[model samples]
Target: MKIQVLSSLALVLALLSQGCVSSKKYKDLEASYTQLQEKSRELNQKYQSGQQDLSGSSSRVKSLEEQIASEKANVAALQAALDKCLNSSSQGNVNISKLVDEINTSNKYIQHLVNTKNKSDSLNVVLTNNLTRSLSREEMRDVDVQVLKGVVYISLSDNMLYKSGSYEISDVAGQTLAKIAKIIKDYQGYDVLIEGNTDNVPISQTNIRNNWDLSALRASSVVQALQNTYSVDPKRLTAGGRGEYNPVAGNDSEAGKMKNRRTQIIITPKLDQFMDLIGKAPEKATKAE
Candidate 1:
């Protein structure tokens, strides 16, 4: 009976040992499973954070693309505005240049008129001074020379020039006319007018009908002496008869009638060049083309 009891005790010891080993293994497996669960949660959290960052980055990229597109459109518009502004500025500059040219052309034409007038006035001064100094001879003492209102008036007594009721000039009168012709020839550009005057008288001679005829014939005689003898230009001379009219004082006095018998020479400058430049500019330009 003692042997049978020991065998049963050994069997019970083996069963207890197996039960303790099984409990230890179960605890170790549970700890390992808990660690694996913690690791899986950490991994899932990292993936979720990565996904959120990617989504935010994509939205930012789309916004940047839209901004770039809007900036390109604005740049195009600014470029067009710049080109148009430059074109208009160029045209405005052309118009300003053209206006300046027109003003300069007008100024040139106006200056031409002023130059021509000054030249003419200077010539008149030269002519007036020339005649005053030349006719200061002793033989020409009775001859009167005066420039009245730019016209030269020369007066001589009829007693010194011709006989009464006769249209014939004396030798002294011919010499005086020769001196006048020399003076007129020295300077050019003069219109000479010779006038004759007679006192209140009636005449009926050969080719002498009245006082008018005598006056005309006497004027003609003086003109012939100037042109034929002294080489004065006939084209520049004009003869007229006063016939007791146009007396300086009165026909009742012989001295007044003698004073009225005078000759005039008027000189005038030709303004054709000045007038053509001022009045016919368009025609001149057309001809130039």
Candidate 2:
């Protein structure tokens, strides 16, 4: 019995020791499992961080690439504009040269016109001087010579040219007419206009009707005398009449009436020459085509 009791006690002690060792081993396994779960959580956090950094890098790379593409397109556009300018540079130079030539031509034409005007003015002055020098004081009293607007106007009083109320020229007028014809003949480039002016008195003479008819007949007679008797060129003469319409003074007094009755010989540069000069520029331009 004593031996059996001792064996039972030993068995109980051994079983208790085995249970303590198993409990210690289970605690160690639980600690190791907790450490492994902590390590796993840390690894997951690192992976998520790496994914976010990669996404940000991709976005930055795409932005840089898009910027580079835009810059390339801008450079291409600038190159195209430069090429276009180079292609058109020759045409621009030609247009500029043509404009310069046109401006030069216009300047030359304007200078030509100015020279012609100056020549005409000088001729008028010379003609006026010659007429004034040729006339005597007595002749000047009957004749008035004036230069107005590049024209020479020689006014002869009716008393010196014709009898009272007559269109026929007086015999004394022949000498003056001959001198005037000589002057007219000297200026072959000028044209002469014989204009008759009369007072407002009505005419009752046979073969004459009114002031108009008398004025016209008087102008015609002077023109014919200048052509036939004085040997002035008929082609250079023009006849006209002004029946008291153009007056130098008031017609209320006898002196004014006498002043109103006169004949005017107007000498001017031939219009044909001026017209031909004016037309020449356009004709030259047309021929340039």
Candidate 3:
């Protein structure tokens, strides 16, 4: 518009120089030129202002775009964290379930062990009672019946079980052995151990070399009598001897020597039963993953 205005002013000036118009027309044309110039100045001012406003608007748009990108990144990071938390919660629930199962299994195994111990104790108590009830008052004077740690021990004096200073079985001992054999036969699952203990006195018998030999022979003799004479199972019997080592009393006096010379019949459940119970136990629990 400025260029068009300047071209029109130049045309008017050239016409005036040639006197193509009167003074009044030239004056009118000059007035139009002045108004056009003023309008051009106003348009230039508005254009400058618009350029400044456009530059500021572009900067604001760039800043807003950057802010939007940053917000998107923050949202992505939060989503990742949420997903990780959800996965961890699921794993934790599974671990808790496994731990509960392990605890339940352990409790069941412990209860089974407790029940087995109770049954063993009951059996031992019944065996002890039967032996005590079967013995006469005179026989009880030389016999001792006891239950220790789920095993039955019936101790008989050496004088009552064997001939004096010898490993031979006495005639009077047959009745007591028969009664004991009957009780042992009743418990088919139990094993009997005949253990002989002698006083510190040395033996001078023909075949016996020392107290160890005497004590061992005494235990063997009793074991043979139970097996052969009374029909007791030899497989259920084990004979052992303590020369003077397992004495119940000191052998310093005759009374202490008499107390120390004795035979013990120990009755217990078969070892295989206990081993089977142990073998059937559950495996150890693993830590939950």
Candidate 4:
């Protein structure tokens, strides 16, 4: 009976040992499952962050492309404007060069004309001196002649030319006028300008109202006399009156007033070169053949 009790106790101890082993295995499996769940949560979070980063990068790339396109358009517009400016500047420079050349040519022509005028003026002075030397002493005393500023100036006092405030020429003045007309006719291609001057005096006659009328009438009379007697071309002659103006001396004394009452006959060469320089020559008129 004692032997049977011992065997029963040994069987109970073996069963308790098997229960402890089973409990230990179950605890280990629960710990491993918890660690695996934490690892899965961390991996999910990393994947979401990567997706956000990729979305931000795409947006930045789109913005950069838009900026680049805008810059490219601006650059093209600027380039076209620059090209236009360059072309206009080049054309302007060419026009300036052409204008400079024309101006230079015109200046050269003007200089040549001025030199010729000087030479002509010198010759006229010599001719006037010769004429004065050849004149009789009485004639020289009656009439005064001088060359000034490339023009011949003659002074005929009231006693020589006309009575007080009279427009009629005296016999002596007529002879002098004839001599001057002969000289003018001999000088071809010369323009004649007759200017009448009067002193500051009032005149109220039946035929003359004021100094201007008297002066104008006197100039006109001289012009008519030259045209009728010498056959001077009307186109080559000009007459003007400067009454009480352009006085040579002050009108304060009798001598000064006498000096102021005078007529001037000016002769000048045709201004061909000067007119050409200033582009005043008439353009060729188109005539039908």
Which of the numbered candidates is closest to the native, going by highest lDDT?
A: 3
Tens-digit lDDT track for model 4 on 1-289?
Answer: 3344445445445656677546565555445555656666667656754564454345534544554465455545555554565567555666655544444444444444345445765556555655554455566555666554445665656567666668877667777777777777777666888888899988779888888888878888788888987688777788888888889999999988888898777776656733543453212111100
TM-score of each: 0.49, 0.61, 0.63, 0.55
Tell me the TM-score of model 3: 0.63
Stretches of model 2 off by over 4 angstroms after superposition: 1-102, 280-289
Model 4 segments more than 4 A misplaced: 1-114, 271-274, 277-289
Q: What's model 3's lDDT at 20?
A: 82
Error of 1 at 192 (Å): 1.9
Instruction: Provide the overall lDDT of each model, using Cα atoms, as 2-decimal numbers.
Output: 0.59, 0.73, 0.78, 0.64
For model 4, what is the alpha-carbon lDDT of residue 216? 78
Tell me the deviation in Å of residue 58 in model 1: 99
Over 4 Å off in model 3, which ranges?
1-99, 280-289
Sorted on lDDT, best first, the list reads 3, 2, 4, 1
Per-residue C-alpha lDDT of model 1 across residues 147-246, encoded as one tens digit per residue: 4323445666666677655788777676666667787786566667778777665676887888888778878887887888888888877788878776
Q: On residues 176-278, what C-alpha lDDT tens digit does candidate 3 reach at each position?
A: 9998999999899999999989899888878899989988899999999999999999999999988899988889999999988999999989999867666
Model 1: worst 10 consecutive residues (lDDT sum): 280-289
Clashing pairs in 2: none
In the range 1-289, model 2's lDDT, one tens digit per residue, is 3344455455546656777547665565556556666676667656754564454345534544554465455545555554565578555665555544554554454455445555776676677667666776578689877665556788999999997778899998987888788889999999999999988767788888788888888899899999999889899999999877888988889999999999999998898985776576522533433
Better of 2 and 4 by TM-score: 2
